[model samples]
Target chain A: MTTKIIYLDHAASTPLDPAVKKEMDAIKTYANPSALHQLGLEAKEILNNSRSKIAEILNCKPEEIIFTSGGTESINLAIKGIAQNKGHIITSKIEHPAVLETCKFLEKNGFSVTYLDVDKDGLVNPKDIEKAITKETILISIMYANNEIGTIQPVKEIAKIAKKHNIPFHTDACQAGFLDLNINADLITLNGSKIYGPKGIGILYKKKSIQLEPLMHGGGQEFHLRSGTENLTNIVGFAKALELAQKEDNNKIIKLRDYFIEKVQKEIPRTFINGHKKERLPNNANISFLDVEGESILLYLDHKGILVSTGSACSSEKLEISHVLDAIGIKHDAAHGSIRFSLGKSTTKEELDYVVKELKQIIQSLRMLSPIHLNKEEIRK
Target chain B: MKIIGYKQDKAWLYSNKVKEHFFNPKNIFKSDQELEDYKNNADGIGQVGSPACGDVMEMFIKVKDGKIKECRWRTFGCASAIASTSILSEMVIGKTLAEAKKITPKDIVKALGGLPARKIHCSILGDQALRKAIENYEGKK
Candidate 1:
């Protein structure tokens, strides 16, 4: 018999909500939203309704919302669209690869980017944004909440500063859907996959006045900001998911998260939580176990049918350490030992209890074979 | 302080053999207290890697009559590195000092079934530490 898997990696991507799936299944996938025929017009109306619903939740005009593939594309349009040529952009070191690599790609062009340092809690200072701004600085990009550590940034204050300087501001709120929306940003990115919506669907909300050159040069859709045929079914699913997410009491899920964190802190010795204690996402629990490599723990946990994730270093192409952990000043060696356990609304207390039991045993056994655990005096600093 | 350098394919991230070693690593020194005692009693010791690259291995051994009687290792690394060190410790014991000295990274890779291409360097860690311990033992003699 196959072991039942308990998924705890919701921050990476959440499962499709049954409500969303139902709504998506009902959508007719025949007519393109752009087609001028009777069915196409009907599709256009459906698409418009979905946009209005999402706009209502985000408190933005429906016309201002630009549909894109996902967080990465939204971010590319937000950053690269504004700073495509010869200017400076300011962003934090702890941003997702979508935002960071977009800035990096801009760096390859004529533009320059300043990667601001985050505090130990993975927060970007608003003053740093003000200090970094110059006459040439065009946009300031930061995330509403980090994906790996789940530390929420000071988006409101940073947006205020950016407004004071009249520089366009963008925040990738890919992982911040369950929380309140940060409405201060000129450009905001929201992903469907992270919020129980279908993958390959995302939103970019622009405040009408913000000018962004189109990334894709086709069909002149999305008011010339983003081109191509709109994905209506996934968009409807995305809207339904967001509507469902906003209606649910996230404090209940937060309670589950807190209980787990409390249990981990109380029972697990020589372990520490990575993100800010209070100012973090309700679902995130990034913890570091001293001397126990996270990948080994991940494999062992997988064997026991408990799913979790390490940083992108282990999961991605590069063998490097996690940029977020490194930015937060975690020692490289200790950073390799970090695990992110993101809870979901569907997560139950019994599942968490089982995880805690297995975790305690795993840590004990792994430490038994750990050389660093054995020679902590000389190796640990 | 890294890259004992062995060829491995990208597809094989971990083998069942590697998992067996990692889940129940052999001849581990257990705690820092035990490691301290093992260090004090060891006839030879070897060290490699640094915290910068997210891996470091330190090994200790006891040699009697030109043969390795005990082998123990401490490491800060990923799954493959930890498993490699554990397997190397078991392989070295009951072998002549000269034979232990001859164990290459490739031998460790072969024994572990196989490791990922990027993680093949981790096997080098075990081989280097063993080589270091054997050299230290010979140097003392």
Candidate 2:
């Protein structure tokens, strides 16, 4: 038999819920949502119902929700859709590459982008957003919660500021769970895979009156915002997934996550917790062990059948210093050694306890072999 | 043989051999306090890369009869870098300095059963640092 696995990287994506899977299997409507026949009507109904349910979750109108491929597509549509390759945009240094790279791409093509600085806790100050705005500024995009460090940004306050300045605001809520229960932004991006729903499905919540140019041009679907054949099965799965997600006992997940972080801090020496102590995602605990490269820890954890992420999924394989860690102003050692342990509803206390036990031993062993010893004077030179 | 299959482990960008050396790296200085013991006894020392750039490596050696008798290293890099350095330590033993000089990143990659395409840079670290230490030793001559 294969080794029993423990998954702790929910921020990248979540396991599909059996309930959602059964829902997907039960819905056998395969016609194009735009077709006018019976199968098409059934597919259209599924699409409408899913959109309505997700709109309810976001407390917005059904017309505001537009289906897309996933978080990256949602982000691209939101950023580029608004900019149309012109005007000023303001974003943070710690945003997902989807948003940062999209903004950078816009920059090279005759648009100005102001990458707002964040505090040491990886939080962009709302006041900083206000200062960066100018007459040429057309939109501001900030993430709801950081995918790597798990620092929840002040979305509503920033949104209020953007509203006062008459600039459209967008926030990538891929890491923000169902019920959103927290952030409120004009354009919010939601990913299906991050919520235990099927992959290749996501939504862009554009508040009524916010106009965005269509990223995909085709048969005038999705209110002309995103045009493509609807992914009815995943859409239906996402609706159920969101409903189940908001109903989950988040307190249990938070308790388990805190227990895990506390155990690591207590057992490991010289371990630094990245991100804000509070005001972070209840399911995330990102920590850095001095002298223990995160990739090494990740592989060792994998050896023990425990899974984790060194940083965001996009940058993990590149083995580069995390920009999120860098934006948090952590020292070079702490930044390079950072690892993220994201909890999900399935995480258990027993698993966390086992992780801490194994982690303590692994860190102790690796430190002995690492060159970053206690002799700091030599390194400083 | 499989490191990528637990929810999202396909991102495990490491070969099995690389995993082996990383989990159990070979000869290395245990700690700064212990390295104090070897402060004056080592023949040559070379340091490369830096923590600021996310990787740094240091190699300490003992030369005997024109051969590398002992090769101990310490590095703050990704798992691939650590594994490559560990394998380098094992490969340089009993080899003359010129033979050790002939060891390249391709040799390290071959010995480690091939690192991930992106991690090939890590293999570069140990060989470069070893060559630098040999140069440092030659300068003293």
Candidate 3:
């Protein structure tokens, strides 16, 4: 028999909302949106309505919204599409792999990139971005909220810096769709899966003044930026999900997130919370339990039906420490023990209490098997 | 052979035997006090790896009449590392030093039904600790 799953990995991906599913299941748009028939015109009208709804929420023109496959494609189009021959780009060290890897690909293609560092709390200094800009700098891409630590960046300040330098700015806001959407960025990326919508659909908002190179050449879709047959069903679900996500009672989720963080720290010894205390997202709680391997603890927790993510190398395919934890200056041993508990709207206090109790037992059992000796005095503090 | 039914198929990372040993390991010290007590009472003690490098194994044994009367271990590592050490302690408990030394990491992996390729390094650790504990026992005589 399968145990009841207490899902705490919302930052990874959230389950689709029932309303979104209902909306998608009701869709009858089967003909291609580009076809010249009455059915195609109906499909195009549905597509435009979804775009207008998203644009209204984001407070931008409807023409600014360009649909892509997902967050990765949107990010790639923003970074690579804006980039031309061998110029400098500015981004933070704590960006998601989509942005980081895209910049790395540009670097290999004879572009110079300045990866600005984050502080211990994983906050990037806007002044650092201003200083990194050069005459050849073409784009500056930063994340709105980090997926691992949930540390939100000062995107407005960074946007002002980019504007002063006459450089185009992009912010991957896939993790921040539940919150405010009025970000002052030239290019913004949002996805469906993170906001309780269907996967495989993403939105890229490009200001009308910016010139972008098309990544795909077929049918001249997505303003000729990303060419593909539109995923009409997913687009409708994405808009509905984004609307419902903003209407959620986020204060309730924040309270549970804080309760989980506080309970884990108080009950489990030698544990400390990662990321900033005040500037973090309402749904994320990253904690490092000293001296225990993250994957071992994860397996133990999984056996108890508590789902979470970890930064430990054993859990990663690369067998490499998390770049986010590494950028925040957490020691290797502490990084190896880190686990992320990202809460969702359905998370309740009793569920969190159960998780804290299970986590305490798991950490105690793992520590008994561990050979590393933690300083008792340091842990007490 | 299920890790979690939801997002990933982590069961593919290990065999059923490995998961069994990992969840409820064999021949492990019950608590910190018991481990401290055994450290003082064990006939030979061997430790391998460091916490900084992310895996460490500590093995303790009690020898009687040139055979291991008891074997117990502790480890700070991943699933394969802990399971390997737990099964290794059980494998060497009643064996003579020579016979125990003949047991290789391959043998441990085979006994556990096989670990992933990247995690094979985790299996090597238990064999190293067992050999070192045997060496420590022989060095005294």
Candidate 4:
């Protein structure tokens, strides 16, 4: 018999909700939204309705939303669109690679970016954002919540700082869609896949007052910002997914996530939780098991029909440590032992209990195999 | 419950042989008692990589006359590193030190069907650990 699979990697990607799928399947307009014919007008109407639905959920004007490929593209557009040929940008080190790499590319293109340091809990100090701002500062880009560690940044505070400086603030809220959506920023990046919607569709919420250089040049679509044939099906599904996500009462998920974190730390010896306990996302639990490698634990868990994600160097192609963990001041050796368990709507308490049981055994077995012995004092750190 | 094989999405991540070794690693210390026993009775011990770097392999061997009679190993790493050391432990058994020393990473990769191109370095680690284990044994003599 096949073992029942337990999925705890929702932060990586969530399964498409059935309602969202139904909405996508109901789409009948095949013509491009940009076409001038009658069918195209119908598709355009559907697109506008979907955009309006999303705007209603986000509390923004329908015209301010620009659909892109996904969160990466949305972020690229938000950062690159606002960037001039040479200017200063401020972002935190714990930001996702999309933001980090885009800043790096800008650095190569004559822009100077200050990668602000985060605290031990992976929090970006708003004062640091203010301190880093200069006369030449163009924009401030920071993630709403980190993908790996799940530490939520102080977006409102940073937005206040950016407002005082008269700078555009961008927040990648891809991982925060399930949580609160009252983010006050000049530009916000969100994607469909993370919210149980179809992939390859994302949204960039730009205020009516802001200006951006278009990343794509085509038929003058997306208010002359992003020009392409609109993905109507994905847009419909995304809107449905966002609507459902906003209505969801996340107390159950938050309880389950807390239970998992508490259970794992209690049952597994020498295990410590990464990121801030109270400030993290309700679905995320990043734990580090000392003296054992993350990829080995992940493989063992996968063998037992439990899917999770790891940030260990062995898990990646280049064998580099996780930048989020590094920014949080976790040692290089300990950084390789982190596992992120991001809960979803379908996750149950029994599933989390099973995961903890299996994880205890796996960590014990891997510890027996390990040559390094970490003491309790070391684990306390 | 037994997961029969690699899932369809991850079937190409590693070869079937590598999966076999990973799921059923040979001569691994499954308990603290076995590890303590090996610590006292093993003829030679070798370790490579470091915990700081995300992989550490501990290899132990027992010799009979001039040939390696037994080998046991463990690793703190990914599936490929564990599988490489697991298969290497089997390869070194029943061979003289010189013969085992000649077993290159290519041979281990060949024996295990093949590893991902990026994981070739993981196989090399086991080879180096084996050579070091032999050296430790010879040095003791």
Candidate 5:
């Protein structure tokens, strides 16, 4: 019998789909796309076809999608590239560190970046973005969906404002693409690993009109924008994964997500949901239990073979609370107790049920031992 | 749960004493009133760290006739850190200023039975905050 482990942390990274794995395996037996030979031509054909497939899913032209290393590189290239040309940028405080840190580096280099705050639900007002825009503002880089809180932003409205002001709009859609292909962005970043694709593959969608100062300089690959020989296998797998994720019924995923949320909320008291209650990603459910640390809860669940995330997996090593949590104005005590449960196409009700059961036990036990809770009780008495 | 760090490992895993403090801290106390009422007011207060750094504490001292009459604290940190602060406050109360100055982070940890190695910083933070508060009190007088 196979040991059952409920894997609910898809937002961190998903296992490669069997179909994507097969596609990757097939690509391994190929010549480099850059070589000058029939095999190379065949490989080039496969690569271009994959790119076109991904573009089709994203509702963008094939030529606009430039493959890169992953989400981090894509975000860095998009932010730094635009910030170098234009000295000012506007972004939200809820953005992933990939975008936030890149902005910080740009700021150190004399670029002015306005980090707009988000509402309690982690939604950035497009009005705020518009108001923050200055004559020197060249880019507005916001995330389509937050990784930790799963709050979706008003990218379409923000994009419209950017277009009206003749500014480039870049959104890191690595989390959003797992739900849909709503490419309401001038420049969009997507990562393969976030959607059951092979790791080390990502795409940057750039409209033809926007001019960017290139981050990489060398062999004029990736239309002279990104200079590197592509990891063909991973790119092929990434495209396949995107294609599959896009084709699936998003409503089904949303229903499952809702069911899980409903169950958890009903069973667990003092549980507060993070992010927008309705305008969130279909597969994300972030919640914080009162009087408990998320790290401790995660450790307990991990021992019971129920894997979930306390915060962004990328920044888990940092002791500070998540920037996403802070942006939504969760109190420090509650922020430290936040947990993100992101689902995937493979997730099921049975798995969610098991996770809910395990979480209730762990949270109750942890709260009992919490000094904060005890202190509150003492005062109550 | 698997303990990840050397500090937590050294302080939590092998020692039953550290676990006792972490799970069941003694001297947990809270007071919302300003420290102004006491004749020997704990005016010079100090707070270190914030929610962002995962630990926050406020330490206050009341002095009478050149001796420490009372010490009180409030903290928002991990169990070991909070417990250590609470116990440290209780330990230093009624002691002379000179004797209280000798109290180190180790003393706070020892008072809590023993804090986990990872949690030694809690004691350190509490000690620093308390010492700084004392220094501020001294500066005023």
Candidate 6:
């Protein structure tokens, strides 16, 4: 008999919700929203309604929202659109590749970018953002929460500074939407897949009067800013997923996540937690096991029908230490041993129990083979 | 069985033995003295591949009146590499230098029951180190 797989890598992506799937199925048959016909009007109405629902969840106006492909596109549009408008940009080093790479691109294009460093907890100090701001700074983009470590940033405080400086602020809120909507951002980007919505659909919340040059030029659909035919089905599904995820009382998930963390800490010796102790996302528990490679642990767990992620998915191809771990100053030994366990709305106590049991066995087996680990008795002698 | 290009079906599989040695390797040795004392005083002294390439091993030897006396090793590599070093140290502890010189990488691989194809190099490294240490002892004489 095949063993059931326990998925603990929800931060990577989530299974589509049944309600979200139903909404997408209903909207799939609609014609293009930009077409000038009765069917097109129906599609347009669905698209507009989804936008309004997303905006309401974000505590912003419907007109402030623009649908894009996903987190990457939303980040690109926000960063690049603002870079095209003015001089310099300010961002943090712990941002996702979408924001970091976009900032690099802007830098290459003669737009200066100041990459502020985060604390050991993977949080950028708002005062650092304020101190880095110059008269030439046109925009300040920091992530709402880190995708790897799940440390929530002080976006509201940073936004206040950006407001005082008359600098537009953007936040990649892809990892924060499932938790809270205390954004207070001039521009915010959120992805559907991160919140169990459809992939390829996201919302970029651009406050009214924030002028952004269009990334694409064509049909003038999204306020002549992002020109394209609307992805009605995925957008509808995204909105439904967002609304459902936000409406639920997530304290239970948080409690279960803490329980798992407690179990792991108690069972596994020398396991170090890798993010902000309390201010981290409720679903995230990133830890580093001394003297064991994360890939080896991940593969061994995979063999036992359990799934987990390393610090960064990007390093899976090259088998190098994660950049996020490096940015947060995790040394080579601890960095190589890091694992990220991100719980989801569907994660249950039974799954957590099974994971803890299997993890103890796997860690013991792996540690036995590691050359770096010596017993306390041996070390003392 | 030949160590190189040996398929799992054609050769005996020894993954379980390799894993056993990897997890519970016996005769682990450490030193603060010169390399020669550890080499001449132990049962066997085996130096394997370089550590820079992620492969390294050192096995110690002690001989008394032409009879092998003691053996210990230190290895820095993957699970199979370290296991091969430990198994080779065990295989050569009681053998004279002449007999130990005849021990090939295949013999070490066979002594460990068997090794995977990618791990054949580790056994080869162990064999080369043991022979080099034997050569070093002979030159002293």
TM-score of chain B taken alone, every candidate? 0.87, 0.87, 0.89, 0.90, 0.72, 0.76
Candidate 5 chain A, poorest ten consecutive residues by summed lDDT: A372-381
Lowest summed lDDT over 10 consecutive residues: which window, candidate 6 chain A? A372-381
Over the true interface residues, superposed, what is the Cα RMSD of model 2?
A: 6.9
Q: What are the chain A TM-scores for all the models, listed individually?
A: 0.95, 0.94, 0.96, 0.97, 0.94, 0.94
Model 5: residues with Cα > 4 Å off, grouped in runs? A312-319, A374-381, B1-141
Q: Between prediction 5 and prediction 6, which has the larger DockQ?
A: 5
Q: Tell me the spans in candidate 6 whose CA falls farther than 4 Å from its real position.
A: A312-319, A374-381, B1-141
iRMS of each prediction in angstroms? 12.6, 6.9, 6.4, 4.7, 9.8, 12.4
True contacts kept of 2: 0.39
- Candidate 3, residues A1-381, lDDT tens digits: the string is 344688999999999999999999989979899998999999999999999999999999999999999999999989989887779999999999999999999999999999999998999999989889899999999999999999989898888989988999999999998878787899999999999999999999999999999888898987888788899999999999989988887888888888888888788888888899988889999988888888898888887878888876653233456899889987676677889999998888878888888889899999988889765334321
What digit string (tens of lDDT, one per residue) describes model 6 on residues A222-274?
99888988888898999999999898887898899899998999988878788
Question: What are the lDDT figures for the candidates, one per model?
Answer: 0.85, 0.83, 0.87, 0.87, 0.76, 0.76
Q: Which residue window of length 10 is worst by lDDT in model 1 chain A?
A: A372-381
The candidate, 1 or 4, that scores higher on lDDT is 4
Candidate 6 TM-score over all chains jointly: 0.77
Clashes of 6: 11
Give per-residue lDDT, candidate 5, residue A104: 90
Cα lDDT tens digits, model 5, A267-371, are: 998887888999998889998777666666675676566778886221322346777776676655667777888888878777777788878987776654343
Clashing residue pairs in candidate 2 (N, C-alpha, C atoms within 3 angstroms) = B4-B9
Better of 3 and 6 by TM-score: 3
DockQ of each: 0.25, 0.35, 0.42, 0.45, 0.09, 0.08
Candidate 2 local lDDT, residue A231: 84
The docking quality of candidate 3, as DockQ, is 0.42
- What TM-scores do the predictions have? 0.92, 0.90, 0.95, 0.95, 0.76, 0.77
Give the true-contact fraction for every prediction, in order: 0.38, 0.39, 0.46, 0.48, 0.08, 0.01
Query: Model 2 over residues A51-111: C-alpha lDDT tens digits?
Result: 8998887788999999899999999999988987469999999999999999889989999
Q: After superposition, how far is residue A172 of candidate 5 from its true place, in Å?
A: 0.7
